[model samples]
Target: MRFIARFCKEKSEYFEIITIYDEHNEKEEISKEHPSIKTITIKNPAGIWFERKMHDDFGIIFEDAFDNRPLVHQERFPKDIHPLRKEFTQTKIEETPYLPYKYEEIDGDGVFQVAVGPIHAGIIEPGHFQFSQAGENMLHLEVRHFYTHKGIEKMLEGKRLEDAKPIVERISGNESIAYQICYRDIYLQATKQELPLSLQKRHALLLEIERTIHHLTDVGFIPNDAGFGSALSFASKLGEEARRKMKEVTGHRFGFGAVSFENSFIDIVAFNEWLNDLDKDIDFFEDWIMDIPSLWDRFDTTGILSLKQAVKYASVGVVARASGVKIDRRENPFYLKHGFSMANEESGDVGARFKVRLKELKNSIEMMRHFLEEDETVLEVAEICDGEYQSFCESSIGELFMSIDIKDGVIERFFARDPSFMNWQAVHIMMQKDIIADFPLINKSCDLSYAGNDL
Candidate 1:
């Protein structure tokens, strides 16, 4: 069962909380206890409960910015109180639960703290990393990131609900289309609208395309870290070609314009041709990587993520799958109807993570081919509508839940939970007992986005 509580303001002294319960009995009990509080019972789409169970442990503890009282949830951390009340301002506070990293002194002779960027030599996003190490061995790594927090949620406030799509698209450039689809689904759900079969097929195809490119770029960096520069170049060329194909269909390299609830610019014949060529190249690339013994030697048994650690941190996506956590949202009946399946690997190491991506890449390609053949027509552009809406999407990375409250076409509240937020902690756990030099390779293997987490 699922439970969601949304805080509302009735007056300064009184707050009205609306709780949505999946079961009628639970809703009745809550309604009876409060008497004045509002409650609703909903039988949500099947399989949502499992997805929620896998990722329901995250919450922030902080002092209410307006009232100066501590605010936090009482679910996972029962001692905490809910701070997301209507009157509470969303501002930084001295007591906010997540603070900048402070490296504790490790007094051994060789142990010292090594601080790295909120900026770096590469063009990657900014995040501060503090390593407490003894010579080459890393004792502990603390990550501090908020440098790229664009106040994305705050930026959506007061804008027309439909107009917020472009802003949501930028939440993570690599996951742009996934974000759009999740937002679109939420809008449709709240408005009680459903897309036609053709549009649903198009949406799935676009999502797979986004997944393919992201994996390509991410996996490419792994070989680069292992000093296989040629593999990196090959992956980059494949990614570039994929993005070029996206431009042909959506008019944007990252697929910003191609996302919608109504239609798409899919040219099935052209896309199939491109997919065939890319498929051959990818197969060859896989074979080439398999032949490289050094790459395998560097990857195997490195950056191990155990099942116990995965459970403790509530890991998701490839990280969780690598550790034998068998929760894959694509197993839902809805995705099955669209011809997709979950991909998994059981080693819980860098090699497993890398193999998981390759397996998913192949799985996505098969889905793309199925979607293209199943629906052979393109869709013309259609206008978007604005209204109150909520949606749950099983994105390539993991499950994403988005909800927007709109009144008179203006957005009031926008909340989203990304997979990156759940998986970032796994990196810290994986870095343990490994040398500082392997940090880059370990990080590339996980590939959790700093921008996604900061937001």
Candidate 2:
């Protein structure tokens, strides 16, 4: 079974560590008297981050873990404090003395290191990347994020379930719709309510639109990073059009509040015309770009993530699909009935990732058109119940997983594992032996979200 997430919840006398997998879930109760448990990293490498995060949050020690370094807490961030403990409810805390983060070092005759950004020149979010290089070739890359960590999960604790929607929607700007859909799914599951087919199609329509816009942006940026400015200009134009259409259909450009049960007013004639135009423009753009040998030269065989590495690290979304992993949550009958088909490539390189995005964008357009034609229906809200629930959605980037525990109509605990959380771990695998100059191109092709991952 594929590993999903591992998180801890505080209890009066103990802490519960819940490990989620694709097929099953396991919970272990660790007595607060001695908060330690056997680590799962030996069998599931992906558990490293989860276990490390649990340690930082709840002071739960994973016995014999390979890497016990703090995941969320920075150096000198008060080693004695565990924020997620039930008793630590202060909104403010004192900072401890500064201590430098210990990044992995490589030693060799000509080895050198390049440190880039927790702050960058561009408008992108903060992340520190340390590259161990020999000449221009990168031997290894160690990425450190969490600078934008907002303590969103902690804030959700004890909040009314109805008031948590806005916070969830804003977790990732580009993935607002996906986050909203997942939140709604969990709420519905907890309340034992099912959405009608019409509403499901409407939700699917919004999700596909979000996916299309993001894919267009990435495909454009990838080419721009490769020095093809024309692709960026054209893709940006198309992306803007899509965003405008999104705002027309749902009052927000990013569809933040569009995932509700009510039917959205879609102008069918205008929508269909836009879809047709997009279809033709995408085809023309693809043909035009494919003829550029130089563009392919930059993209091909650069920043490769092998199929083995993707599977081993549990990579998701385009990163996994490009590497020949046929794992998409959209394979259900609901989506298949709407003309959805999985898009994949096997090269596991920058070129393959680009192709996968293009294919998925086209597929999303087709699916959206079909979903828009579904009949409209009214949805009824169900009373919220005290229970724990989990849900997953295929976000534009990859699989997004959310879990929430409701107690007396308030959120007791909440956790969301964004696709970026998994895909970020596989980035270094793609960078191995590649020249550092191609970092931007490789990074754009993957397009992992910092906000989503950091949260």
Candidate 3:
């Protein structure tokens, strides 16, 4: 563990840069192990007129350098280029020579390569998956992405404190609410702001609703991988109904405008009616899981990712929970006060992933009901303004994290880590020892966001 930091003052401009490098390469003693290199870089805006006290602003970036070396900074930067420096204006391009991305080479007579897309069958994002296969069994798989890179982080620069939420929400269309909440919390923390108790409950309710509905879509697709068309159709219908109910309450099928309370609030009577219907649908789905022996046969022991691999890859969210890795942010004291607990399954297979989501779905529903029943008069809102707010609440798919830096009453920088950003690599692990045909089942089990990853 090496920690390096320095402060430079030149011509009345101030700059501070901090870097931590792990010499032993040991995992951080946290609830979960993430595979990406951990790196921190912070840049505070310079100004002499600002009267506010100097505060530490931390920024963490995770990535690997082209040579497979551990790195946390931008992958596109050359060794000599320091783009974050104050003197650097325009981005210099083509300084680093192009190098073709390497893929796993399979040596044999029968082995062959199959290229699957920058386009796909579903209305999905573009990304290529190269598979090395011997007949039907896959020897290696490489995922190539960044075709849709939108430079989201760059776009955040110079934005007002209140104006960044919409851009953050657009990071992933399916997981919009989670992104919004995470970014909001980070900004609130940096600004020393707080939300009312009623608003907190509302925030949590949106999270659970997002989780339940998204899980319904993911788990429903698992059966489809096994040629169970009816199951997929049923799950999609229920999931769509859940979305419609959300739109009815939040004015967006994906819960778009719900983040800003000025635009929305949950109606208890209508929400209760919706929940009652949803509960019945869940019961039907549960019964189907129990009755269908083929479903079990397809999912059980399939896409088996060992607990060791889960830790090695730092898998988070549903995949990690299914593998018996207990890393739920909701267990943080903040959410515990709101009644949150970790959920897990030990098998770490497609079946285990499905089971974990089902169990979490139940937990979300229970939490929603409990939140709805809380006393309204006591649920006071907290002021959002310059303080650190770090609390854990669950997202529909997995844990979401954000950190914001504010200085002199202006937004300094914002950083967020989506669960998909780390867990996409888990797909390769899940593919191991499984045939090419099982790709859909294993891939849909994780249901990672390509846009989130590319960002």
TM-score of each: 0.78, 0.98, 0.78
In terms of lDDT, which candidate is strongest? Answer: 2
Model 1 over residues 1-455: C-alpha lDDT tens digits? 33322323222343333333324222122221232422121222211222221112112111221111211111123233222433435455333354332344456787898888879778899987888898898888866555675656667777876688888988888788878888877766556566777777777788888889888887798889988899889999998988887777678899885676546456788888888888888899889998899999989888999987776666778788878877665676657866676767777888898888888888888888877634444434344345556665656676565667776567766766677766765577787878998888888898877776666
lDDT accuracy of residue 209 in candidate 3: 79
Residue-by-residue lDDT tens digits, candidate 3, 152-236: 5545655666677777788887788888887766755654556777766777777787887899898778888788888778888
Per-residue CA lDDT of model 2 for 345-385, tens digit only, reads: 99999999999999998998899889885356777788888
Candidate 2 residue pairs in clash (backbone atoms < 3 Å): none
Q: Flag the better candidate by TM-score, 1 or 2.
A: 2
Candidate 2 lDDT (Cα, 0 to 1): 0.90
User: Each candidate's root-mean-square deviation in Å?
Assistant: 7.7, 1.1, 8.5
**After superposing candidate 2, which stretches have Cα over 4 Å from the reference?**
374-376
lDDT of 2 at 363: 95
| Ranking of candidates on lDDT, top first | 2, 1, 3
lDDT of 3 at 345: 93
